[model samples]
Target: MEYILFQKDDFTEKNYIARHEEGSKDDYDITIKGRATISHGGRELTIVNVSVEDVGLYGCRISYFEEHQNQYYHKASQKVFLDVKVPPPEWRSAPILRRYNQVTDTIYDGDIVNLTCRVPGGNPLSQLTWSGCPNGSQTDLSSSTEAVVQLQFVASSSHHGSVCTCTALQKYASPQERSSNVTLLIAHPPTLDIMASPALPWFATGGNATVNATLNCTATGGYPPATLSWVCKENSTQNGTEGPSLLSVFPYVGVDDDKMVCVCEARNSYTAVKGRVFKTIQLDAEYHPQLELTALPGNMIKEHDSVRLMCSGHGNPSNITYRWEHGEWSMAGSNQTILNLNRTDTGNYSCTGASNSSRYGQLITVQYLPITVNYLDVQIAILETNLTEGDNVTLECQTEGVPSLYDFKDWNFQSYLMNDTQLLNGTRGKILHMENINYMESGTYTCVVNNTALVRHGSKLLPILHSPKLHPYRQASQQVVAPVNGNVTLSLYIVANPEPKPADFVWTKVKPDNASRNVSELASSAGLVSNLTIGNVRESDYGEYCCEVANGIGEKLKVCFNVSAQGPPLAPTGLHEIPGRTTAISTQVQWVSAFSGGLTQVFVVEYKDEAGEIWETSASDINDTGEGKNVTHKIDNLTPATAYNIRVKAKNSYNGGSYSVYSDVISIAMKGILFYNLLNENLSL
Candidate 1:
């Protein structure tokens, strides 16, 4: 047998030292070297046969040249203890089992292992056998009085924690059999898998910007357990040690996260050689559909005209479907993208797509203004009746037509004479006002409305009966108030023997220059009463309005009123903390302004610590000049290491109106505290 004490290709020469007893001061005889053969540049020492005399410590000294100093010295040295066995008279001891290296009992899967069982001092060479270990080859290295068996096999995960037993049997001994056992510790890489909370088809519902989910990485079947970790695009890497799984929280998963890949990795002690195992998952998300309704061949639909309305939808899922509805009922059996116009189609049309989101289109009115005179006769309404001679009267004509009568025609008046109607010169507009109407003027009066493409007439009989005393009266002026971007209605009640004509109801606004501008175009009449609506009122709309009435029976009466602008301002928008302006004790907040509601408005800044429920107004009375302008305010006296929620609101000056709704809440943390906490966590890790 050969024993290599020390081997190094770089060494120049090697020396050997032997001692009969380990840890003894006596030096071994140099003559013993003559019986042993040393080869391979003195690296190996071989003896033909080994005996108990070789049981001692052997030391090796080697000399190697140092390139830096250019010198060779016997500086490197190593020593190993050796044991020798011989035949014994009778069996006395159990077998000892150990691996070839005798360094560690742990082995990795797929590794080759060699175990030896030796029994010393046994008569008739006690039989050495291996048990518990399967699929292993055994070799006999027996002497006259000793028994030895070597077992070799490949390690596997199944062999972990299993006991490999070596037994020595002597039929003549008092103790017939003795055994030694060693537990095998096998290491293997783990299998990895990733799981998600609220598992697939992630939907962003409730108009939320992002949907939150949790990802867990699990490792299974590894000795010494496995460490799990996660890697994501939007989140920092996280790890878990010797656990069933590692969790990663995704707080802001949106439609953009679709197909985003996230990785989970697992490793163990054996993973160094086998490499880490990982599993990946691509996010699948479903978001609300974005829809647009468009009309084909033009939106001005006419009766019996063909129309196509397309509902274009975009969303995460590619298989989105659509449905069309008109007014209260679905368009049954109709094309999903088009609807033919009918004479009765005069209401709203809407569209709905997958994701169950609905969108409304503009009001559709089917135009049916034909040139037939019956159309006018069926649609016209006469405003005045019961006329008498020598009495002033006002007549109005109401009709429906496409493009509006005001835009398509200038109302023409005609009178029936000699059993025929002729155009009455100097008579214009939808209303006819006659002064002191006499029997000579009594006849059938007609109101003519026409465009370049069509013409129609609406007429009524004005017969003289008997004369009666008449009086014209006007009501007092009233006060009206509204806010900017709001609507206001100016109403007037009139009483007279003959009611005022629709054209006689005039509205005018007094300007700051003391000049009057006719706003009569905004007026409409239902009977004896007239209403003038001012929509989306502006700053210039605040003033006095006057209504004048003339019936040829009394002096023209004038009614005047003042219109005042007042209301709360609109809510502040785009509230956020101004970056690079926040500190440990103060932070600057910014927002965009909205309408002032026709009154002077001021902004109020409010904030509160995350732990507190009550919000504290940090700054109030911040000056604002106009809408759509960015405004900023600084809040101070804040504590460090604290998180705060901030918001802004607009209030009317002099408490004229209510405060506007609060802006969106924003969160801000003290600058240094975040870095400090992160640094501490890293240090602790």
Candidate 2:
């Protein structure tokens, strides 16, 4: 018998097992190693310990002999059909893992990992499966007896040290399974994290002397361990430029770490081959910001000039602030501020730049540049000093010259023909102190200042022994005609050789009520024209105003004028007369008081009978008390049963003050026959 297998695809034939019942004794390869096998069936073919060569279409042939007519002949039977198919895949060997097409058990994270498993031979075509792989993997079984399984996956941190298994089994056969496992080379990038070694209390306060920021970095993923690196950067420079640089190698924080940004980085690669993964984080080590101040127009600000200032510095935190400080004023901005420089702004200025952990300051001075005048400005406000012989006068002599050198400036006073007296001689500044000044010291005061090889002088005329003249508010009379509840002015002028300085003018107002106020300044000047402004005057403010001026030479010279705040007084009302005994003519009449004209006065009461008498009897009541009071008096010998009416008038010290005007009155009065029937009966008895 001969067993032959036919390739299903090509119908090619191959002899598998052969046996002879009767044949020559030269065939010796049968049943070698017991691998070539057969089972009990004349036509059935079975193989044990199968290999890839065993699977195909199989057939069995048998030969027989028969004797006929005394002669023996040989006959051959037809080939019987037998087919062999592959079973489910069974692992013949171990699985292989590859990274980047290289055989490696260590696959790094972010790498595509490849896995392959193959079972060479099985009947009925084995199905292949992967144990530790994504679902829906494909099995390759195109060949009748060989099964191939391949899988591809991306390596991740979770895949580290995990096992990848390829399994094969024949479902129809005894549930015997074969499997191969490969420890996955899950190479992953380094696990990266950083922290301040010594925790910090506060990260921002400009510069904190206590802050020493050291960043610790760690890497934890991938097969072979990962390495750490660091980069250093300065937020900015003194010129406000970003300084970005890296360190030569990984190292601990150095001395220059202050105001330096240390970036921690972690690196790793698949197969531990070359650098691939890079993770970085920045750490800030705070310190005081270096502060500098620079002014526009170069620091020496002239009066009425506008100056701008800028502050620049560097710190660990890139976010910085700029503030300008002069005295108690501070402004916040990016790095610049502006100021309108004036005489009051001459002082030391400080600019502060602040950062997270520290602050820095810069100082500079601002003042008026030296004024360049060809000659000294001997400015005497008024030629009439508005002073007297005994007045202590301060003669001001101002000029433009180098005050630091005495040769630049000098002061002298001289009369018409008297010899010049050196008053002030100083290099720093020039002024004259004329104590107990007399007429002899009155003339022209001169300031001599050297102007670059030229001796130039400025003169101011001075006067002595003059009094201040007074003038009311542009009115013919020396009285200020002030309106009620309105403002008024009592101005005065002086005709002295030198005008009085603002400090020399004094004024006092003696109110009609003698109510005085604290000394107040009401005088001002506009060149040679000087006057006092009286504001918000009322009728109660009506009184004499005395302006006194004395140059310490004679008694204080005083000028007096009058100002009034007068208006109409309210009308008096509620007037009535009380009746007495019918036999008696005595009666009492009373009425309310009206406007006092801002003064203590009296009320004159006049009444007459309705019989057309013009003026019957009139009486007077001294209104020595204040206004708003009732006045009553006794009238003797009054005839009863007579109709009468009374009227009143009020006056103030102000000339032509207010009196009752028609019906602009808020009052009432009662004058009628008094009820005296009982009194008349008693009188009759």
Candidate 3:
């Protein structure tokens, strides 16, 4: 028989064998069968039932027997080991205990607290429980397997000296447990009492004395905690909160000490316990004696002046006395004191007050005085009534004052004066004098009078006058008037005493006929001379002119001439000639005088022969245009052998005025030089 151990369904085939000697073969018939077994330290281990203690080594073995020998041989097989493994179980420690939080020094009535127990290092389990004996009674609690647990509604004061436990359970180890003892301090929340220092008396004056006070309070024990607040009893004013069992408040002064109380309150939020305490203090009131001094006409006393003084003292019990002292004077009165002062009495003044039986007295002082001026008046006058171009003027100043006096003087025209003398006339007066006066002396002059306490000022100046004149007449050259036919301006040379003076100018025209015509008159403060215009000029207006200047002092005149006309021939318009016998000879001439005039009479045409000799025709009467706009003239019987230069002029009969402009010259070319000889020979034959 043979056997084999294997896991479930591990073996697939089985074989038989016999033991034999080396190199020799002996055949024998043998049967083999496979057997298996599995074991473990605990119950049958399977995947579904795996655990930490079921893990180990596992093995399988095979065995058989030989039958060729007559004697049967027994052989044992090697041992097989089996191992099983399991996973560990989950574990955790219990929660840790926190320090106890106290609410107040004293706990009363309904108070609650939390007690906790914690454990560590455990697998698969822990439980917490609370046990206590308070007020002769025990608290019962059930065992729990939770990591943390809370106890609620613990309003009993009898829960003092309670024990709380935390237990941990492990699969193969002893169960662990942690325990703590809690002492429930049973007390009211806390009672606070506030006390003010220097307690008040029952009866006192209303507002005479100041009251000083301090406040204090205390808090007792409780579970969660308690706080203290100090409040004023009369006004319900909260002062402050304190944490310690005792609190002190800073000292304070009050206007009146009546109806004053301090309240101390304690509160615990964790429990419904509160406590409060209050105290009343009394204070005595008294009126302090006061001394006051008043001078006549108010606080300000004028310098070097006199004043009447009064003193007053006030207190309670109608036993007040007053004493007044100013400089060397002193006096006493039951309720008032009076004093009279002078300049020597200008010193520190004091007043004292006393009660009938008191040892001390109150005092006040007067230290300031008003300001005053003994005299404040100023007078000013010029040193001289008559002033010249380079003469000095002086001003005198005066003022009045007492012991302390001053003098100040200044002049405005100091630049023009050679010697400016400033002198002190008296204790409160001055004198200012200018050494010279000139053209620059025309300004405001001021003199100032001053003292240590006041000032005065005055001013005066001298008036000056002179006459202005214009110079004698000087001739001006003739002028070529502008062709545009506007006013003819002529300037004159003249002089006046005051370089420039207000003057009037008269402009006149002197015609060729030696007659003068006043054209216009102009007035100007500036000495410039100008003439009024003859708007449009004609041949009649071409003549000599004069400008005259005058002032109240004198008058002067200068002469010049204007040669102008409105329109003349721009060029020679009729510049042709007439035919002649045996000679191509003609006259060359120009037209003039586009406008008829008052003295217009004769026209003169001048020319130059081809040999360049100047020649003139006798003055000829020109017929006025039928429309009376212009004049025209003609000349004849000229030799054809000559070329000519020609210009025209117009004249006026009234002034013998001549045209300022000449007509454009015209030049003629002869047909041939022999034509003039032929004309002369033909005429002779």
lDDT of 2 by residue, 606-634 (tens): 55555555854456554634444677765
lDDT of 2 at 605: 60
**What is the clash count for each candidate, in the order shown?**
0, 45, 46
What are the lDDT figures for the candidates, one per model?
0.65, 0.51, 0.44
Candidate 1 on 1-685: residue-level lDDT in tens? 1122332222333333432222333232364555566555455566556655566566565545667888765544565666664444434557777663324555889998889898777445678778888577878877754677889899998887788888887775667787888888788877777888878756654344444688888777788788887887766678777888888887877766677788887777788777777889988766666566666655556545566666665676644566667656565321343345554554556665553322211112121111111112213344556665666787776766453444213333333224545667766666677877764565667776764323667666666443211212333236566877899888777654355667766677754534333477788875457777888877778888877765554456567767777666779899888879988899998899887765778899989998899999987889995677899899999988689999899998636457999989999997544433644653211
lDDT of 3 at 475: 29
Off by over 4 Å in 2: 1-79, 83-108, 122-127, 134-136, 170-177, 197-208, 234-261, 271-403, 406-685
379 Cα displacement, candidate 1 (Å)? 27
Of models 2 and 3, which has the larger lDDT? Answer: 2
Residue 386 local lDDT, model 2: 67
Taking all chains together, each candidate's TM-score versus the true structure is 0.33, 0.38, 0.23
Give one digit per residue, the lDDT tens place, for model 3 in 1-685. Answer: 4443332222323321222223333222222111111234211222333343323233233434555643434333433333332111223333444335333444345655544444433333355455552322222232322244454435453443344443333333433443454455554454445454544322122242233445556554444456666565455555454474544443444324334444565655443434443333333322445445666655444344455556665544246666666557667763332333333444556666655423222322232223222444555666676564566766676554432466574434332123463433442336656565544444455566565545556655554321222222342334444444455444454443233343455556666644334355422235433434554455566777655555443334444555554333222234334334224555433353333332334556666675767677634455444222344344456666566666665544534344534566667655444323644763321
Give the C-alpha lDDT of model 1.
0.65
Ranking by TM-score: 2, 1, 3
User: TM-score of model 1 relative to the true fold?
Assistant: 0.33
